[model samples]
Target: MPTALTAAYILHTLFAGVWVGAVLLATWKVVPLAKGGDLGPDALRSIESGLTTLTRLAAVVFVATGGHMAATVYGSEGLFGTGRGHLVLTMLTLWFVMTALVEVGGRRMRSALDVGKVRTAARDADAFLKAASVAGLVLLVIGGYLAGPAV
Candidate 1:
């Protein structure tokens, strides 16, 4: 592989890890704390802000690097017809789903947190965040499948 493409792959992998890890952390840890009133409004808002920023950054990087890889490796004709192309498409769909989930959930949580309703914020955001977490995990699985057998 070319150096540029290799670099793209490396960046793509790193961002994917970060993005998914954040989602999982929010779902498994942050939400529970908020629901239990263990976290303050300021802290929750900060976390939500951080997650939003990370999600936005990851989305841009994923689109740029994934698009470059698809164009370079699959080309126009290969994307629609190949198995790998289909996996890429699946990943793209999941990416959108995860992003949207986070945005919607974060907005809901933030609004309630602004009012000092920690439990309400957690309740409102819980389902969306959980779904996003599941989608993120699925994306990783699909990514591994696309990677094929390791050498």
Candidate 2:
């Protein structure tokens, strides 16, 4: 493979790592603390802001590098045809869904939080966030499997 393609692959991997890692950390550490009353509303809001920044930055990098890599390597048919391609497509779809969930949920949570109703909006949505986290892990596992010597 060309040096440029290799670099793109590495970047794409790193961006995915950023996204998946942030989500996992939020689900495991932050969310639980907020839900368990260890963190107050202001703390949760601070976390939300920081997480939002990371999520948006990672999303841009992930999409740009992933699109470039997919186009350079497999193009359209390969993306839609093969098993590995299917995993990529699934990741893209799940990424979209999770992003939308975060965007919408964040907005709603922020609105409620603005009115001092943090627990209802944020903690209640932990279930959805948990599911998204599990889906993220699944995506990582599939990507790792595809990255094996077979592919």
TM-score of each: 0.95, 0.87
**Cα lDDT of all candidates, in order?**
0.92, 0.76
User: Best-fitting candidate, measured by lDDT?
Assistant: 1
Candidate with top TM-score is: 1
What are the per-residue Cα lDDT tens digits for candidate 1 across 1-151?
Answer: 6698899889999999999999999999999999999998888899999999999999899989999998988887778887778788889998999999999999999889878898999989999999999999999998888777623
Regions of candidate 1 where Cα sits further than 4 Å from its true position: 149-151
Across 69-147, the per-residue lDDT of candidate 2 in tens digits comes to 7898778999998887887898888888777666665666677678877666567657667776777778788778867
In model 2, which runs have C-alpha deviations exceeding 4 angstroms? none
Residue 94 of model 2 has an lDDT of 81
Per-residue lDDT, model 2, residue 10, is 87
- What is the Cα-based TM-score of model 1? 0.95
